[model samples]
Target: MDWPFSRRGLFQGAAVATGLAMASRGTAAPFDRLRQKNHPGWVIGHLTGAQAVAETLLAEGTGCVFGIPGAQENELWDELKARNVHYQLVTHEYSAACMADGYARATGTTGVLCVVPGPGVTNALTGLGEALLDSIPVVAIVGDVGNGEKARPFQVHSLNQVDLLKPVCKAVYSVCDVKQIPNAIRQAFQAATCGEPGPTAVVIPYNLLIEMADFRCPPLAEAGVPFDDAAFAQAVALLGDKRLRVGVYAGLGCMDFSGSLTAVAELLQAPVATSVSGKGAISDCHPLGVGWGYGPHASEVAEIAFAREKLHPHKSGIDVLLAVGVKFSEVSTGYYGNPRPKHVIHVDVNANNLGKAMPADVCVHADVGLFLGKLLTCGDTLRRPTDGHLLAKIRQAKADHEAKLKAIPAAKCGVDPLALVAALRRGLPEDAMLFTDVTASEHLAAESFRVTQPRTYFNPVDNQSMGWSIPAALGAQQAACGRTVAAMIGDGCFLMSAMELSTAAREGLPVKVFVLDDHAYHYMQMLQKAAYKRTTATELGRIDYRAFAQAVGVAYQEILVQDHLDAGIRSAVCHTGPVLVRVLTDYGDRKIRWIEAVRDRYAKELTPAQKARFASRIGYRTLSLKPEKSD
Candidate 1:
């Protein structure tokens, strides 16, 4: 018997033979016969399992993949390089996943990542968990040991990769045969993106990746799920009560349907408040947008009262809350201190999420985009409440918040956090993508900075991880391509993933990294100071970030005063490649005092039972009634 011929040759030869037979009858051209023989669903050529996966990704219109090259996955990397697939080489596997998460959030598409098994898979779990919690669509391709060798004790870097990833991933697939690669990847993409999107893991055994096989790409799956029409009608009737003071609360899940949500809000003349993760879903500058001022730290009931007082002083608390794509997460609900509305119309893609945190009077199980589109069909019949007073209240509330920020005295230690935020807000482009790490800077940015576009602001939100911002910003910039991207990170956060700057430089990603150098874990310090009256082990001796940036082959700048802040930010934003701008910030106790003051104000608004519940939910000791002197 002749040795097995390559699949490419076999297919071409068969096509030519068939064409000759058909051409004798003058039925069709040889080219047409060849084309028909190699229809999209047919196997066109032979390729390694790795190449098949790469081709599948390209077919799905994946523009870039963030990952590290490793022994087990080197074949995949090689295939990606050969096919001109854009692979961003991250310094760590965790950052690779984070970059994918950021890319997915920025582009509203499935982000792809490839890494090796064992430690590589373990290292990426945190990022996967973040993606899972945030509902980001990402497909992670992990390379594992040879199919039969997975259970072998001596196999290097071999472990139960699927088991380790199952909890964090939406679904996990292990490819045992070479031919399973394409379908597995297609399914992984589908699983990652359909409904409440999340990360999915596809593990390809090392042997299968390098094995040659005839490959055919699978047809894309239909991803949309139908909505509950009965629930939609009920929601419409419930929300039609003109006596109800309605407020639309949106979250990250509403991002795809942001336009629809805005249109609905406009039709109802309702003010819209977003959870921190949902900051950009509606432009903060929109007339109805209330911004991210309703989190655990940000008082919700008080903010709503404030908004009502400013806009409709005669009206009572929000009678109807239209929560769209929101989980009513503890943080967003002020540790459940904020009372649930009398009537709630909750809409989400995932049925399980409806009424989990707060009871829903009418639950609509549908894609937010679809639900909002359907809701808009009845927009003409719905009454639009007078919003002139509401608009005035919104503007006044913003002005009052800014006034309070401006009233904080200048810091004696370093640059004031508020002042630094002002500089950043002024210097950075309005459309620039900004990421904030968990620190005093995050609070400052939350209260001070205004994000005018959707998906322009990225925060750890519920994850609250320290090192997420830099790598995430890098990935967002890669997804955005030419758009300016920046991450304002605390000193502690910078140390956690600063090595990624090297990856940024190597990839030629022009990401501006701003280190908010307060010389300590300021957020924790504030907590300690307020709860214990002193801080311990929160101090971080200043690192010469300029020298560190130089070592990593990135341009660096240090801003010590307000005057240099704007120019420094401008320089970094305008730099051709990665640049670090370290702003030495003050460790003022004012932030701590502000936290205490806000809590006190919110406490006064809560009932005894609500206060106890809040305390229990936060799992912290009762704060001392004695007020500390303001610095």
Candidate 2:
């Protein structure tokens, strides 16, 4: 046993030497020698295990990471900080996921989120579901217990975390080996941004994160494939067929696509209809921009009908519909059946969406901006609205629709949802963001508010899930500091996520929640009355919302009249932290126009008297706002 110069000593010496070699610059280890150059981007790294994962994130150009680094995954946090990457500590895991989604929605790039186990995964589920439905690109790197050693049953740190997330994620990767982390991250990114676009999950075990690194992965940034040029040419050629009446349907994807949106409008002299998400994608005042995506009132109906005729197939007054980046959904399209237009040409980044149900005669799985730009530059057959009579018909349709939307008179105790939305729009800044939940409250907001900027309106309309408004607004507030963030939730949706206001308060995020207190889901009531002709399970029990707000230590307000609306909004905006404004409403009886429109459109043969009665009840009326007390 003299000096014990054994194999163990030699192994220890080699480990130290390897560590030193890794620390030295320009020293190529076996893993480094095997690293692939010219793979995707100029940025490359030789990393393995948890360090490799961190290096992969850096390679992907992720400037910021929104998450709380828990005890189990502090190593990842340390590595991120070491690389000078910014980390935002969101109030909760759900907020972290939503914050990333909002960032991606605003920036048009994939966002990154990190979370711990069990509850963390559950908390993030809602936002991830929303991203999946909306075709947003987001990546969630969740931490798990490495090596699967659990002292107790159902422990949070189990390796089965990837399996837990598989149902909701676009793709799930359980990295078991230290060397596989880099490629796993790259695949996660690809799954998120490629094809239909959605969220992907990469689960890293805590034990694995601490393992020694063998290599680093380089960033996989590269120019996306060129837009389908042949499709562009075909679209241009189809538009040139003067035999067809071509109309352009625009979506949010076209907001910054000045070249393409403008060129297509000018070339085809076709009016443009935008989805709610596409509000302001094209200038509302633009001559070619007809109106919004679907009909909420007469204005929308008239605009859509006018647009349909101009783009109908067979060039028979309306022959072709060039829909761009519009994810035609039920609410956006008034729940009426989406009639396939003649020669339907759909161009969207999500290829899976192009031929969905309503088959597209010309499906261009390309970016709207890129494809439109090329078509505008190469195609020369598009023209202005040369037919004066046709333009007038379109104008008349819009005017009639607006008049219908204006007809619903508000009862003495009821508030006009549209007017409230208009007030919010008027008082808010151009760049201010508004978050809203599904239900009648959102419908009114969409109908009345006119957004002209990106990230100006944030509605969780994708999954059509309730209780998303409050947390989503908190996420937005965290992501966009110093900007006004407000969530407009119905009495029903408000109650679901209202408890999270405590988190908002603790985080010092100044998010205002406006509760439309109508004592029920008014939209459901309206639908029941129209369809089933009865109200059931739509009423809500009364509670002191102001008291609830006060208990949460948030500024509280209860407004019952139009005169108090502006003051309340201004006061909330000036508050330092969270505020809850309960605007008592009686929209319970207000009629939803889309439902009425559908009824009238599909009414069967009727007698002279029946026809007269239907026509009289078909028109819209404005609901007048009045002062009232909470009885």
Tens digits of lDDT, candidate 2, 123-194: 788878888877678899988875644335555555467777887789999887776787788888888877
Clashing pairs in 1: none
lDDT of 2: 0.70
TM-score of candidate 2 to 2 decimals:
0.79
lDDT of each: 0.78, 0.70
lDDT, candidate 1, 329-447, per-residue tens: 75455455445667889998899999988888888998888888888998756667666866776777677766775665667766887787777888888888889887866766765
Q: Which regions of candidate 2 fall more than 4 Å away from where they truly are?
A: 1-64, 67-71, 74-92, 148-159, 221-223, 255-259, 294-317, 385-411, 529-536, 541-543, 551-553, 574-577, 595-631
- Measured by C-alpha RMSD in angstroms, how accurate is candidate 2? 7.9
